[model samples]
Target: MAVITTKGVEKVYNPDKIPVKALKGVDLEIEAGEFTAIVGPSGSGKTTLLNIIGGLDRPTAGYVEVGGEDISQMSDNALIDFRKEHIGFVFQAYNLIPVLTARENVEFVMLLQNRSKAERHARADELLKAVGLEDKVHKRPAELSGGQQQRVAVARALAPKPTFILADEPTANLDSESTANLLDIMARLNQEEGVTFVFSTHDQRVIDRARRVVTLVDGKVDEDLRR
Candidate 1:
């Protein structure tokens, strides 16, 4: 079954006034464990589409189904619960809490899920190690480098054992080497853990790594290519 599906999805900011249509009749599907990248120039609808798919925003028209469930039909509270259980996110900003240690930041998500303290700690530790940050577990975001912080963010995103990960310009802040390392880690996780990865990126490095690339132009899908 398709893990993510969109049917004629449309997102308009202003209905009465000049409507800024961000996503226009977008229909797509993402299979489980697929590493898909939505590539486009700035002002394209890539991020908007990603946001809709991840339940960060609602479409003005049409529908989005994730993991066989129609999110458009869910209540706001139910969508929030669905997100907590099914979706993971990584942003270019890292978005890690400055005061929390790397491991603590990862554990925080599990804590929110009401996971046992021991289970949270163990899972967080394992994820940190998986992201190659075992030594930096005790270090706060300020103490870590940009790449290390992103790794911590990745671990935090994965702490809940989420079914899919949605990353937006994840490599935009990283240097070439750091981008390589981060993408390698995520790619390996996709292969090994069967975690679906969908990213919105303009970076050529990210495009090269994607198994399938969906090109967006002016809020519409222009091309879908498989490598």
Candidate 2:
């Protein structure tokens, strides 16, 4: 199934004035359970494209569908609800709250979804242990290593059991060992949990791991290669 798709999609920041079209007539489809990479140079609309697909931004034209729903047709409130229900995000920087423990950080996402306290704690604990952070669950992000922090972020993103995950340069700040560990974790999730990963990245390691690579150039697709 096509979990995410766009056709003739466009995002124009200034339509009347000097228009800045971040995504220009982008047409693409990403299947469920696939590990895919959206690659391009800076400002080529890779992140914009991900935002549109994830319903973080509206398209000026064309269709944007996620899990077969026309997300562009949804109201702002509905889009927020939809995202919380189905989408997960992992950014390059580990956006963990320093005041919170690793378990709290993971539990936060579930709490946002109005999950019960018991359920939240259980899910967070399971995820933290899965990421090899069981012993450090009581520690804050500041106390953990960079790799450990990133692992916590990943665990947090998966706590909601989201079908689709949008990761933007997730390995950008990591060392070689950390990047490899993170990539391995992501691969394991895709294989074991059937989580679909679609990431925007300039990193070659990410592209190499992807089952499909979509190349963007000048706000349009230059190529789509499937492994």
Candidate 3:
């Protein structure tokens, strides 16, 4: 089944004063359990498209469907709830709460969802182990290396068990080895757990690993290729 579908999607920044068209009638579909990458040069609307797809931003025109539900017209409050319930995000900067330990960071989302403390602890442990960070559970973001922190972030994003993960330049801050390790962990999750991943990145390393690639140029899809 298609987990995400975007049709005639368009986004315009400052429409009244100085309009900047970020996306222009873009169409795309991401199926369940697919590892897809959205690639483009800077100013090509990659981030804008990712934000829209994650329901962080709204489009000027067209529809965005996640699991067959239209999220295009949701109110700000409703959109927030929808995103918490269905989507996961991992950004370039690990974005972990510095005060929280690795395990606590991973458990944070489940805490927000009102999951029992026991359930949160179990899932956090499982996910951290999945990312190969079981030994660093008590470390804070400040104590961890860039790669370790990002791994923690990955575990945190998966805590809610969202329908899919939206990762934006997730390996941008890592060194070659760290990047490879992180990618391997994510790929394993995608394969073994049937987790869908949609990434927006300019990194060739990421594009090379993706099972499908969608290239955006000048706010439009220039090429869509499957490997």
Model 2: clashing residue pairs? none
2 or 3, which is superior by TM-score?
3
| Residue 165 in model 3: lDDT | 96
Better of 1 and 3 by lDDT: 3
Candidate closest to the true structure, highest lDDT: 3
Candidate 1 local lDDT, 1-227, one digit each (tens): 68999999999988899989888899999999999999998988998999999998999999999988899878899988888899999998999999999989999878889999999989998999998999988999999999999999888888898889999999999999999999999999999899999999999999999999999999999999988
Candidate 2: minimum summed lDDT over ten consecutive residues — where?
Answer: 84-93
Least well predicted 10-residue stretch by lDDT in candidate 1: 67-76
Clash numbers, per candidate: 0, 0, 0
lDDT of 3 by residue, 1-227 (tens): 89999999999999999999999999999999999999999999999999999999999999999999999989999999888888889999999999999999999988889999999999999999999989999999999999999999999988999999999999999999999999999999999988999999988999999999999999999999999
Model 3, residue 18: displacement in angstroms?
1.7
Residue 132 lDDT in candidate 2: 86
Q: Report, for every candidate in turn, its global Cα lDDT versus the true structure.
A: 0.92, 0.91, 0.94
Sequence-dependent TM-score of model 1: 0.97
